[model samples]
Target: METLITDIKIALGDNDDFFIKRDYLIEEEVVFLGLNTLLDITKTKTTLQKQTESLILKGKTTQLLFNLIGDVFENDTKRAISSILEGKLIIFIENTKQFIIYEPISKSINRSIEIPTNENVIQGPLNSFTEDIDTNIGLLRKQLISKQLIVHTTSTGMVQKTNVSLLYLNDKVDQKLVDNIKSLIEKNNDLEITDLQGLSKMLEFSSWDTISKFNTTELPFHASQFLKRGRVILFVNQLPFALILPNLIWDMFIVENDRNFPFPIMIAIRFLRIIGILVALIAPGLYVALVAVNPEVLQIELALSVAQSREGVPYPALVEVIIMLIVLELIIEASVRLPKSVGQTITMVGGIILGQAVVEAKLVSNLLIIILAATTIANSTLVGTQSTTSIRLFKYINIILSSLYGVLGLVTGIVLICSYFASLTTFGKSYLYLNIERKDNSG
Candidate 1:
């Protein structure tokens, strides 16, 4: 260990300060002090004894002794020695080579808890999770006061030393789902698993391919409900949200408070969001088909009105709709990136001004303006921005296909979207369609 430490010092150079020493038994108790100027020896002893005694009691260590700032050598070496030199304390026995590293992490930076800005609900708690892992766990424990709740913590990242926890209910969760999640986590050993999104991508079986595989939410109550329904939740250190697995596509459309509402109302809201998703994705395509090639399909009065509205416009129906769609999308992107106050103002001004100006300039028909405005409003109701953006993209694809090939192309696009969605699965479970086996668990 001494030679290894010495070689490491030379290899690492002055970039890192490493001090090691040997322990000599003094007065029945052993004492060896090994620390660089980087460590505060005055408190290292206290932190060291506090960290290792439990491991020693568990029969993992035979003896412990303080090492001088330079006494450490090959006699008691471990790879964790570098961490010890960096303010962590390492305790080694005399005969064997295994050692335990303790981190008395400095509590220097303090962060105050703030209300959740993005997911604010008028009735729920204003408090939100912070960067601290323990604090986040405490928040969950408070919400789910149950003995069956199991939280398994493991160290992830060799250098990052990030703490990741797998939380689930003991009896309710399926064992196979837990095993599958563990398998994925173990396989991605060397990949950087820092953020929740990175961890999600690594755990995804089809990460390199196109697939909607997992569900993530910031609401704690939403997580608690999922735990009760036999799903696995992954909690990453410093991340405000947790990832829930084996997610059904229908699950995302259901809100956290849906179960609290009357059954009829819940069903209505869920169906409404589903309808909104359809409108957001296909409204423009429908408008293009009707106005561009099927104006006779509409009744006489409506057809005449549309014809009169577009009489002064120079562009074709498809071009006019696509142009307005692009402008609306730009406004939406800008609103999302701006501050909340500014976002509201931008949405209002952009919606009213652009809508009126386009009609006044005879750029697009009045009916198409209404269709585009409805499409934008429908897209905003989705819970997650990721899913919303995805649906928005699909909307553009639908518009392009309809513009080129008319009504039949819109039908073909629908079939293709259904086929793509149906082909996705997470760990052998269906991702898009609902399972009727558990008919009573819709809530």
Candidate 2:
């Protein structure tokens, strides 16, 4: 009991200097009360002492001679510890180990609220989840009041003690999937509790060299949608994002805005997104392969134009393409690191001025310029940064392979990438078989 008091004092320190008073109720009966705030000591005297004794004596086999303090120790260890640090006073009755927890929350609620940047909406709730897990959970719980809306939370990060919640509808969700997620989190391996990326890498079935085959989302609407579809959602405290499982390649092409738009418009946009991904992934590679080795496929006028554009350039087609690609990537990197307004300005100036200058200098062909620009624009159409990054990386592999074996190498790279995707499985479920209908013998 004294150790607990010491811990409380240490947690409070100079910020909350609660006075510890020891007094006698009757002869041989003593009480110790730790008071930081005045309101707790003033209201309800006899009940406070009774509540404290009951709490400390809870589940105890031996009779405690000391009168325990009430209000503080009623909760479990985690909640009790959390309350103490948050400015709840712990008072103990003398000759007993019972204690009471006083509620005097030091939290301030004056901050102005704003729309979340990551989870912007066209026609939904403007509010987004913040760093507070209770607030986030409250938002979700208000939306889903059913008993089926299960919120199982666990403390992660040994030192940080971060709260991680697994939310799902008990009746609608698969029990096996829930158990799998629970078990995975329970392991609490040192490697499993790092940054979000580390957690993802541990949970994801992608190989050491494989690109990310999962989708991450920040919008609660998306998460709620997935929950209704019998999917599981994993949310980490202090992280603005949540991870969805069993995501397919097509998932990346989807946007929350799709639900607001008309079905036909959404379908058209989805088709365009699919096309964008393909073009972004392979356009530059195809251009490099065709120009370097397969000129026979080009029309006479196109061939002449490319040849004219390449004239007086010292580097080979591959070297020139590689150089331009690297430069474009550097500009993109710089844009990401710069401030938002500055980044936008740099993109405009770099996209136009530098690109046009390089084309006029005969350092790169005009056709290549168009292809690269198209690829960049296509990549930008992807909703998630992960997908965009994956596209960028595959583009490199495609370029290199295309340069080596021409069109055949590009085809081979595609096959290899597809094979890798085929090999991936999350929680023992195949990642790429989302649309495949399976036979349900029992049904």
The candidate that achieves the highest TM-score relative to the unseen native structure: 2
**What's the distance in Å from true for residue 170, model 2?**
2.2
RMSD of 2: 6.0
Least accurate 10 contiguous residues by lDDT in model 1: 24-33
User: For residues 109-186, what per-residue lDDT tens digits would candidate 2 score against the true structure?
Assistant: 423235767555777666666666666677677766778789898876554566778888876777787897788677
User: Candidate 2: misplaced stretches above 4 Å?
Assistant: 1-3, 7-95, 109-113, 189-194, 201-209, 435-443
The lDDT values for all models are: 0.69, 0.68
Worst 10 residues of 2 by lDDT: 61-70
Q: Which prediction has the highest lDDT against the true structure?
A: 1
TM for candidate 2 is 0.79
Global CA lDDT computed for model 2: 0.68
Q: Give all candidate RMSDs, comma-separated.
A: 5.8, 6.0
